[model samples]
Target chain A: MTGKLTVVGLGPGSPQQVTPEALAAVAEATDFFGYGPYVDRLDLRPDQRRHASDNREEMSRAAAALTLAAAGGSVCVVSGGDPGVFAMAAAVCEAIEQGPDAWRGIEFAVVPGVTAMLAVAAKAGAPLGHDFCAISLSDNLKPWSVIETRLIAAAGAGFVMAFYNPVSKARPHQLPKAFEILRAHLPGTVPVIFGRAAGRPDEAIRVVPLSEARADMADMATCIIVGSAETRLIARDGNRPLVYSPRSWDAASAGKR
Target chain B: MTGKLTVVGLGPGSPQQVTPEALAAVAEATDFFGYGPYVDRLDLRPDQRRHASDNREEMSRAAAALTLAAAGGSVCVVSGGDPGVFAMAAAVCEAIEQGPDAWRGIEFAVVPGVTAMLAVAAKAGAPLGHDFCAISLSDNLKPWSVIETRLIAAAGAGFVMAFYNPVSKARPHQLPKAFEILRAHLPGTVPVIFGRAAGRPDEAIRVVPLSEARADMADMATCIIVGSAETRLIARDGNRPLVYSPRSWDAASAGKR
Candidate 1:
């Protein structure tokens, strides 16, 4: 029997955000592989088994899952947010490329879901309504210099920036440094949104201007969105403000560079 | 009773891709407003009224929805793909900002769903595995020069780019021109994926090297993803090739500029 491997996104820590297609994929799988927290999010039947590993072991986890699939076991690899966005989908593809040739025959499908940036942007009233870039601030797989270069390029091109892995216990300086670099190119009045655990019970969405934006406002679970020069904020009498980047950009006056 | 306005994403034309939150919002709405095709995607109850308009009439549609919501009608604005990404969420926000102080008093929520780029990336392995940017190639709102500048900047920064609205009957030259500009900055070996109506019945995904990419492969319904310089393709004996951009980058050797 030919085995199958399906990659599914659980959609940013919320049951309501999970799609019917993702749920159906999970229901059809016999085995699941993912980080401990992500795997724990699934309600697997007693007949199904889950192989949970540390978050840093994506490559080995992918390989192990592929091996199980190669042995004719239906397997699913789970990721928080859309699997295509800096998640397990890439790891699985990399594994198939480097692993045994027989693994190539395994049926592969990726079920896309709501990514963190989109979830965060929705809660903040569409700060990503215009052109945008998503960058992971963690320097684990890539160097800080590469991150800096991308940040400068994204900001210079007038794209709103959505940052994943913005701050962690080990990487405390990167987010602050990013803010400094963005301030150099954009106005201090541009809004910076820190959306943490969106769609979860403990969700928090905070909006501040670039001049007063701080690194301490974000954590590993947080997705930070920095607005472009044209981004706007609408303040209400007794409610949280709405932040959004306008869809129209006048080339006659703005962002020729 | 206070009125409520909810914006929901329908998720790339597939009913299975829609989230529970979006469904709930749609069910609760007394009136729906959107582009005709997007509004038609919903199975509305007899009591629910739909106000379908042309695609270019976003501002008027948003204003009409807000007017209904402000007058104590439960309103929903429908968008294909995640509403915040070049969709109705921004239009709603723009309307609220420009319309009236009373519009600010209306309760608002945005329900995020699977975006076209993520759906396209999922269908073609994970081309967005690293830092990436989403740019709309249409010149309806912005000048063609702005799009050109963004393409250059995104290519120079080594970003995988997901292009929305790559080609339309009105704007055929822009996409071809975009390809010409990208070839100057990126290697000809990079992969370009044209994914049309992903998750729908007529979904089509095609992959080609940048040197062989043509604008004819795309349309208004397509999302085009151009892999970064580090992207790789793994061939299979009988299956379609897998394309992905590696999550890791060596700053010492790559994209220092």
Candidate 2:
């Protein structure tokens, strides 16, 4: 039986971020598969099969979704944040392509959603307005050597960075290592915004110095923004705060136009 | 008279990406102001004030929205991507803070929406799954020197980079300059994905080597993604093609115990 797979992005926490298109995709699916925490966001029917697990089981979970889809189920593989940014979209596609012969007839499409970077950027102001990049501190799949190379390049380039998978139960020291690498090139006083569970109920964001940002507080759900030297936090009246990433600033005057 | 300003993200280019909450926000607003190209996407009453203009006029349009909000109008300030990125929310806040006594009392709230970065990331597989940064090449507000600094830092950090406002009428060479800086630290063969008018009818995405990417293509409406060395592209059997950014091959090779 020929089947199809649709990868949907659940967006940042809060139901408000779920687009109508994503909801419609879920409604049309014969089954749903995703990380356990994100699966709870959907309303599943009795006939729908849901394959949910922790992040560690992403590969197996993806394989299972492809298998189900091959068996004639129209499956929606879901992810929190944008499915393409540190989420499950790529994994699912990889699994489908490499899976057994039964999955050959499956059609695939990836639908986009709001990502944590943009969500946190919105919450924290314009820290991402200029050139930026995101890196995961977890070394589970990548060599620390490769990550280090990337970190050095990113820091030297002066691009603002959004860090995902910074720290978790299995790897407690990754974030600190990343911070240390960044400190080599960036000044200690550069602004770094730590966003914990952004868009979730316990959302917390604080601007701290690069040297003072706590590595222990990060997790798969957290997003850390390390700004360029030009990034600044301005405290305005009425408790309105703005983070500005100076895309254009004269080095001689150190003032933005 | 009391008034409020609510900024909404339209989510790339499609109605499917508009969240229920964003729809509700629009329904509740008494006035709406957005980029002229997106004016047709919303259902508005004839009496509602809809302001549209060229992209360069965003700051002025945002100022007008703030003025309307200050004058007892419930206004919805619409941005294509998330308002907090490079959109109108910051401009609105800045205008209100810098304006005369008339705009001091207006209450403002920034709403999150899907961004082009996430859309492009999804289309190009998971180029942003690890660490990444986004920057605008526009020198209208900030200078090229600061942009260079951020680009170098991002490159050194090895974070995936997303570029917004890469080129405009007056700044045609800015994108190439930014590319040159990124090329210095990044590998020559790194994957660079250029998404032109993503999620729109005339959408186009091209994958090119970092060295050969500056072949006279990118423009103001484009969002460019430069993947790290680990990013790879694979062609599927079907008509649909797939892109993959393996966050850490070592983790994937650990073979899911």
DockQ (C-alpha based) per candidate is: 0.88, 0.51
Location of the lowest summed lDDT over 10 successive residues in candidate 1 chain B: B248-257
Q: Write the per-residue lDDT of candidate 2 for residues B228-253, one digit (tens) a residue.
A: 65566666565435666665554442
In model 1, where do residues sit more than 4 Å from their true spots? A251-257, B251-257
Cα RMSD to native, each candidate?
1.6, 4.1
Docking quality class, candidate 2: medium
Query: Once superposed on the true structure, which residue ranges of model 2 sit more than 4 Å away at CA?
Result: A100-105, A145-152, A180-189, A209-212, A216-220, A237-240, A250-257, B100-105, B145-157, B176-190, B208-216, B249-257
Estimate every model's Cα lDDT from 0 to 1. Answer: 0.92, 0.76
Q: What TM-score does candidate 2 reach?
A: 0.87
Candidate topping TM-score: 1
Instruction: Kindly report the fnat of each predicted structure, to 2 decimals.
Output: 0.91, 0.67
Q: On residues A1-257, what C-alpha lDDT tens digit does candidate 1 reach at each position? A: 76999999999888999999999999999999999999999998999998999979999999999999999999999999999898999999989988888988999999999999999999999999989999999999998988998999998889999999999888999999999999898888889999989999999999999999999999888999999888889998899999988899955435423
Interface RMSD, per-candidate values to 1 decimal: 0.8, 2.9
